[model samples]
Target chain A: MTSTIVTAAILAIGDELLSGRTKDKNIGHLADVLLLSGIDLKEVRIVADEQDAIVEALNALRKRYTYVFTSGGIGPTHDDITADAVSAAFGLTCEHDAEAMRLLAEMYKRREMEFTEARQRMARMPKGARHIANPVSTAPGFIVDNVYVMAGVPQVFQAMVDNILPELQKGSHLLTRSLPCPYGEGDIGTLLGAIQKAHPETSIGSYPKYDGQRFSTELVVRARDEAKLDAAANAISDMIRGLDAARAGSNPGPEA
Target chain B: MTSTIVTAAILAIGDELLSGRTKDKNIGHLADVLLLSGIDLKEVRIVADEQDAIVEALNALRKRYTYVFTSGGIGPTHDDITADAVSAAFGLTCEHDAEAMRLLAEMYKRREMEFTEARQRMARMPKGARHIANPVSTAPGFIVDNVYVMAGVPQVFQAMVDNILPELQKGSHLLTRSLPCPYGEGDIGTLLGAIQKAHPETSIGSYPKYDGQRFSTELVVRARDEAKLDAAANAISDMIRGLDAARAGSNPGPEA
Candidate 1:
């Protein structure tokens, strides 16, 4: 870990998610975006639309990580209480912001639609929070106490993330190198463990993929240092080749 | 909420998920299964492949909820440390079980494959844990304390869940009634709030969806009691009809 390592967590809030009615797309999208920004997405928590659950998760994640990004419950509805929960988390009252209300009202007015109180609810945010622009929808997300509250809709949530990511601090990009090993994980586990111990800084991940007939492992080495990453990848490749050679030497022909 | 309500939290352990390489399919599948079993899937957390991260999350979730279900990190690989993490969380040793070894040996012998030590890693589990059968794959998941550990592969995970769900305790099923209101949530929020107040037992969730031109709210009322659920659903329907009538009466015509 480096001194400038930026860590983040995502709090996906929705009852639909808890009920298994909605398969989450935001978590993966946000994870990719955060990784590109050199932010380590250390943890992710999904909770229901309940205020206490959201508030509790928000406070815990916000304290533990460098930044906490929340999706869902920022819509114009009664159950969309993300802003309120965020406000409650920080001991602040949620009130409609002048600027957010102005944007929403202007948009609704231009469209000849009712700027109903529920529509105005999207403008509500915790005190002392900065508004995050939502390019897809006019309603803005808000950032309070290192927590960036965004909409739950995939498109809207993605737009808000795109708008906010550039402003966040970045660290050294974590680079990765992968090698496809034609052997089962058991065949390479001990050697892989040794290699991982040798290269402590580079995080080694052995992912097993079993085909219909056999299993193969994909060894991925990730690190901030390019040199160390390359070294680890090369070492893993050599280990695989050595294993193959030994197997071939012992059994010259096809297995009986 | 009833005294017999069995709550659960899923700890999805995998670096691939955190890195955005694999979109999770296990959480939703497990959630649906738990719901059918009358288990409330209250929370879900995703963490990296690190043992400390997995152990910390496992400990927190296992203690907080009635059951903590985990998926991923239990495999024959260097980074598959879920078993070790579970053992550490409960202060138990992760050693290969005689029965698990016997099963694996028999399966491998039948398939005419090598029974390497790495392959034996799947047999390792926390001391005093009960094995959960995996119909798809022979590798068994284990239940330590209230934590049910399963594999990451979607098919295998689903199979393990099916094998385990019937044996766990069940609670009263939470049934839901959804009312699709064409009116925006703001138009019905106040009334919905009042209705929710009248029926405190039901959980009213207001989910808003935008169709480019207008926003509609999906008001979902969930409760264990069928009578209370029906009562709340009826109240919501009446409110929607009243709003539509009011809107038509005020506008008089459908022109701009």
Candidate 2:
């Protein structure tokens, strides 16, 4: 409910995602969660699990956004290098967290598995990071500065996010109203642009959807101000009505 | 075929996507298409519908990758500023192309609709750009320099990619083989890392999958050299067999 403009960026770290082997389920889910929580998702970058690439993208996003949420590259495998990259981005020492190690060790004991050296890799985090709980898996995700390093697995990432969202700062809710226009963008683009100019506070967008045979446009009006969003929606509705009436009147006659 | 290392990046532009109202389907589709076509997808960026942001991301990607493929923001609406932003990215003038105008006009004429100023907006392209045909809709996407501007609609974006991909330089085919390890990443990470170090020519990735109960890992080895790929795959297969044997022997009693 605060008018604060809290923004976020998602940095997906995995070669599998870039290879088309794994379609990213985390970005859209995070985007939806952030938007509903009143945080604006500004940019999303999908980089391979290369440390340099992860560090570069992470540094860039973390510097600009209120929060930089990263997924992948935090497992036990050698390819899991996100924590190291995030540490490098912040110029901090990455070492095993005593608490994380204890939690993971306890989880392994419960599962009747050895706490192998490789599994202990999951306990490593940047210095001074608060662990985000993973309800599904025992290994925890960590938040260092504004960067929240998360697992690539969809279920774990979602679970970690559910834990993280309640702790972050919320912004003004971005209100939106969608009106379906029977006509396509061609019929309403110019008028829509004018409405946008008239209501400068609103961000008006026309998205075209095709249903096999013909095209239709959906007019979405978004604004932080509810009054401005409503005004823009009304203008678009009026424009659509005018177009429909004109088309109806000309149905029986030839072009002028 | 050719062993040229062609790399590409995808720039998905839309506010709806960032807002989470629209789930993105183009990035992964493009990634799959690019990988199968022998072009390596190096990066994927999802940006909002701002012209400055588009230009910044487009320039950054186009300069680094062999090709930068963009989707969204090419429709007739005001929010469709990708064409102009791309033109700015390459420092070229955006104007109506004669051939594009003819094609769009003909499409409108055939549909018995007026070729309004809004619809005519679809014909504009950067100077010295070549049109990429959209089979779904007559309005063509365009390519300027190494940047391919495409539609946002999944059907149209895919059709445009079909037309543009064959014309680009194909890289060496990236061959891969997947071996499912019954053990999770914690069980095989150390050995997998050793295997990767032994075969520097191949890239090994261990992805963990959970089916609600237990976690299993999928080890994928990728290499351009077939012999090297097979050699690494065999090493991973041997490692998995060793782990399976050790587990089977231990199941009869307590840990050794």
Candidate 3:
């Protein structure tokens, strides 16, 4: 509904992720980066390293969102098939990229090691794709069309995100305001619903947290327009205050 | 293909997750639990609180995997519409269930709180769905067909997984053996590929780790059958030792 919102979907590829051997650190990191950049991370899909699964998820996500960011399976291993899978998804041929190969060759030369066939795998990408720099690791990630391919390692992925983010076109920033309501959701649910209905453009989310001693709800109102956000947040605050006053009148204590 | 492998997909529902306001704590926890239970978590999807998005993802995952687990948006708030989305997905009416209402009413009575319309929303479920107990909170998750809906709270989600795991019939345990290769993936990539080709049934995953000083690859072979696992693991060990011997003949150093 917000036309100015730039949407993205993340495709996390690796067998270790699905097998529970590796806990993914890239999704949240990318999510935070995208949020700050005014891009809406709309969906995330985690699939195994199988080429078909990766290709399927990649194509689907790329078609749905403004950008598709893929993490993992871009390393120097037999299971590092993200490049090939992504190429396949775009109907492009995978080949060793010149700049990527140059970077890897230089790094390997400095280490006095052979850039073997397996090591060279890190240089492969879909033809015509531009390379994204990786300061942490010598191997580079690539960007093709709307897809940005990055490494799976937390440090390398974060670096690539930083390097690529500046080149992206910015969109309208989504404004958000969080109000901590001491009352339970049950106590203020009706009033909150009325506020949401009144301000249909703003998305009001109620998240309840129980801290052993008491239950509290954090009401987050998000919208593209600042006016809508302010209206919804003010309405929510008034509802919370009304509930608090009623509770105090009955209980007549600070605990209320 | 491992026909005996029971596959599952997780659908994480919430606008908070998509907006990056909430770092998802449920996926990794569920993945670890499902892996230990002999169920392969094939895919995971994080979608917004919108009913259409939830229903679309839920239907897609339910039909694709042996089981589907959904977490979040099942609370007492206007935005908590997961039950309605799920019911719409299955063409089942969403209404208050007697057992769920009874459980929630008792809990509210114990706390001397009013079970308002919003609080009662937690008791709604699709027709013919059975309730899954929530010891952390009285509002129960539900299981309809192959879908298991659960809370988004980490503690509550984990408790539901523990409670429901024993009830489902488990498949053959996926056995895995990891061999720590001192050599990098590039050093053993070709040999590892040959070994993988020789053993078609076992899935060999190469995970490279850099521990500051050196880069090493951990070769993890997973299979349902024990014989296939042992065969693949032996082949991998032999390949690593062959690389080690070759390295020693060339360098003849303690590092080699």
Best by TM-score: 2
Residue B138 accuracy (lDDT) in model 2: 90
Residue pairs clashing, model 2? none
- In model 1, the clashing pairs are none
lDDT digits (tens) for residues B158-220 of candidate 1: 889888877789988988888888976656766787898899999998877777766677888
In candidate 1 chain A, what residue range of length 10 has the lowest lDDT sum?
A: A247-256
The TM-scores, one per candidate, come to 0.92, 0.96, 0.94
The runs of at least 3 residues in candidate 2 whose Cα sits more than 4 Å from the true structure, single-residue gaps closed, are: A251-256, B250-256
Per-residue error at A95 for model 3, in Å?
A: 2.1
Supply DockQ values for each candidate.
Answer: 0.64, 0.80, 0.70
**What value does DockQ give for candidate 1?**
0.64
lDDT of each candidate versus the true structure: 0.86, 0.90, 0.88
Cα lDDT tens digits, model 2, B1-256, are 3368999999999999899888888987888888888999999999999888899899889889999999999999999999899999999999999999999999889989899998999999898899999889899999998889999999999999889877999989999998888999999988888899999989999899988888899999999999999999999989987887787885755543
lDDT of 3 by residue, A1-256 (tens): 4547688999988889887788888898888888888898888999998898898888778988899999988887777899999899999999999988888899989999988888898899999999999888678999999999998878788889999989987778888999998887777787788899999998899988877656688999988888888989988878877886886796787565
Name the runs in model 1 displaced over 4 angstroms: A1-3, A250-256, B1-3, B250-256
Docking class of 2: high
Top-lDDT candidate index: 2
User: Residue A233 lDDT in model 3?
Assistant: 90
Query: At residue B82, what lDDT does model 2 achieve?
Result: 91
Model 3 CA lDDT for position A20 = 76
